[model samples]
Target chain A: MKIRTSEYIITEVFHSLKRNSWMAFASVGTVAVSLFVFGMFLIIVMNMNRMAVSLESQVEISVYLEDRLTDSEIKAIDKKINEMNGVNSVTFTDKIKALDIFKERLGDQKFLLDAIEGENPLPNSFTVKVVNPSLVKTTAIAINDFEGVETVKYGQDVVEHLFDITRLIRLFGIVLMILLAGATLFIISNTIRLTVFARRTEVAIMKYVGATDWFIRWPFMLEGIVLGAMGGTVAFIALRIAYNMIVAKIYDTIAFFPLIPTYPFMTYISIIIVCCGIVIGAVGSVISLKRFLKA
Target chain B: MIEMKDISKVYENGVVALDHINVSIDKGEFVFIVGASGAGKSTFIRLLFREVLPSSGALIVNGQDVVNMEHGDVPYLRRGLGVIFQDFRLLPDKTVFENVAFAMQVIEAPRRRIQHSVNSVLDIVGLREKYSCFPSQLSGGEQQRVAIARAIVNSPALVIADEPTGNLDPDTSWEIMDIFKKINGGGTTIVMATHDKEIVDIMKKRVIAIEDGHIVRDEAQGAYGYEN
Candidate 1:
């Protein structure tokens, strides 16, 4: 690793790349496309998980009070629910606030609520969120037996189906990511193998001239690193631009849809992808060199 | 600088390349190994450089055990010797100077030493003016000379050439031989495998002839006794 050797290796790598410009282009292109696809799926899986988490966190039990409970009795019920295991927070909404929320949700059709304006039938209810989404059903059932509580409803069937869907999404995302990663490695390595195969005679000559395995391998490994870094940069840029466009489009159309913000999330994804590209590049070169380096 | 005791090579396909060969070469001797095609001459040269292992025998080349040497040590063994091939295996992309300098660079020679040694070796091979020319720009003999320059750039104790003149015309082959003669005169042991009878008879160096996996003759100042 002397300065002279490093200089030689860098020169050799650049020389080989220049000599086999087409092969180098093809290798870098393959790596970029493969990593781009991987990055796209990764972004999708991450955002899906984020959305799933947001949805799950919104699941809460609605505890309606008995028709005419005193304010003190309602406060007692709130305290009791707050002390319950797994209860994250309990917020009581009076009948007037319930009516206001219903009207807001009605949006441009708030005129429908005009027919019942004088008689607010909404009951006082506490929205109870649990520490864990999976505890929603049990927590709701436990809250139903509280004194002075009318009934607890957490949209049991809808919550159950949402959990099932999110679980499926997470499992599918994991399996798909693993499969895509393996495929990317296989393809990138094979592309690198072809480049190495083209220079195999050079390797043989170096070997005969008493070049150590590392001495001969250093240039190729460096070539791989360069190609990988270049490809990773291309993919990172493409992913960033594409994600931003998609985020803008989604925000424009479905403004309420939950998407992970583009700041640290994309930054993290870029780091992971570039690192993957580099590692795959280095590993691919080593694997390709294995057969040729044998004496 | 080489000792082979009861050497034998059996390829995996059950072809016997060499059989029970015993030979010892001193340090500074120019020996030519002559044989017909597939007559085990190549295997003999290959064994000297530890390119292929002996099936069962002991081979000591430049004081290193060729047969039992660790794989990691093969490069060290090869470093002490120079090897040339008939096809003039120069990197097509490298200039003549870089090609020769590559040998020194492989062993991590200092930059100044590499520059100095490469220039001197190029001078020896008479390729000083053609240092910037690629292999494709050179004629067959000139390319071989560049190859020679590269092989000897490190000043190895021994030089091995397999058909160094096989692809050149007679005149060009002789020109390549003159460089080998000059190198050998400088006290480097050279083991060459060739089929050129005229050059062999004229040089009158030690010759070993192999046929069908066995050495049939070993003579000092011997001629290539085979018909073309």
Candidate 2:
């Protein structure tokens, strides 16, 4: 097709949209709202995962050394623990230092300190920060084999349960996105199908007139794309405004929650919304066109 | 040229619409396919356009084996022919100019070419003044003229009119026939399917008569042969 004619087709498509502005707007509005919900949920799930990771980082593993270890042996074990996979950092806390910190906490409890006597019962230890808190078991196992290490003391049950919760959340979040994507496709396709059905005669006549399939298809495809993108833009704007409002209201109460990534996440979702809108609109137009183009 | 060699069409219910219809028309010939309702005239014309496939036999239009034509080539093939309907089938919402321009738009005719061609055809149909008029705004005859203008604007090799005057008064029908004659005079072959006996007789063109899904007569300068 000539470039000029292609422009005319686009003109016709946009003109049709204007003529049916109310209907077009309604359809686009639905797409925007649906995608907004999907995008908002996505940001929420991502932030929640971030929060979980932050909380997990605070739980450190302490590896106690056996009393018989020489300075060289302790140094060798420290090096091994630090070199282990998933161990982020290792700091040696000498037995005397650990007792001094305990005493500082129990300032008026001289009797309690006396019960422990002058002899320090605490073992010298290395506090380990794991790069991945979810891999605590693996890190504990690696440390357990160290020659002078007495025990790897991370709260096993709590870490395992927390890890399981994060995994479940991530899985459910993915499944939800998949289901919502499918729903968006379905709704957009049905909407375009109705538009195609309403203008089946136009499509039939265009075909009979010897119009190329693409020539006929371009306008409808453009219409779909426009609808999707408009919807996505509206949704993105609504989400941004809504997120800002919610964040402002809950800032103090939710101090433990990480700072909102509203701007960056909005940018990411805008890209997704535009892409999804275009894809869905094209798909919808294609489905509706398939049956009507037989002429 | 258009030719149908022993073409037959049978619906799935075993009702035959056309039975072994063998016919041919040379380029520039103006012929009439005259038959009563359900006599298979529509089916015969529809076959040439590949709108309906012949259940058996070969149908060729301008050397293309339309009977075996692939689905993708149908539109390209149709671009070489124009099909007009009895109901005038102009989009009511579009102005007369838009209706004519639609033909060129489908073929991706450039804006300048489409504008030039639509104006020229509208002039030929003597409706240049009604360019902005919608189908509903025009009279029955005027709307049919717009339909004819759309059909012929592309300078197609063939123009198929199915009961072109079926919905018009005798006076308006005659006006439409004059427009068809003018188009035929321009060297485009014309095939019209109609039940208007008086008009067919007056035109005195070659008439192919069909009855009960079969061609009953083929005569040069013939009249509508059968009476109701």
> In terms of DockQ, which candidate is strongest?
1
lDDT of 2: 0.86
Off by over 4 Å in 2: A55-59, A71-76, A83-86, A96-121, A133-139, A153-162
True-vs-predicted CA distance for residue A215, candidate 1, Å: 1.8
User: Which residue pairs in model 1 clash with each other?
Assistant: none
Please name the candidate that would achieve the greatest TM-score relative to the true structure.
2
Error of 2 at A21 (Å): 0.9
Tens digits of lDDT, candidate 1, A140-165: 98889989889899999989999999
Report lDDT (Cα) of residue B164, candidate 2.
92
TM-score for each candidate, following the candidate numbering: 0.87, 0.90
Over B1-228, each residue of candidate 2 has an lDDT whose tens digit, in order, gives: 988888889988889999888898999999999888888999888887888888999888977889778888998899899999988888878999999999987876777898999999999889999999988889999999999999998999999999999999999898889889999999999999999989889899999999989999999899998774
Q: Report, for candidate 1, the interface RMSD.
A: 0.8
Give the alpha-carbon lDDT of every model: 0.92, 0.86
lDDT of 1 by residue, B102-219 (tens): 8888899998998899999989989899999999999999999999999898899999999999999999999899999999999999999999999999999999999999999999
iRMSD, all candidates: 0.8, 1.4
DockQ of 2: 0.66
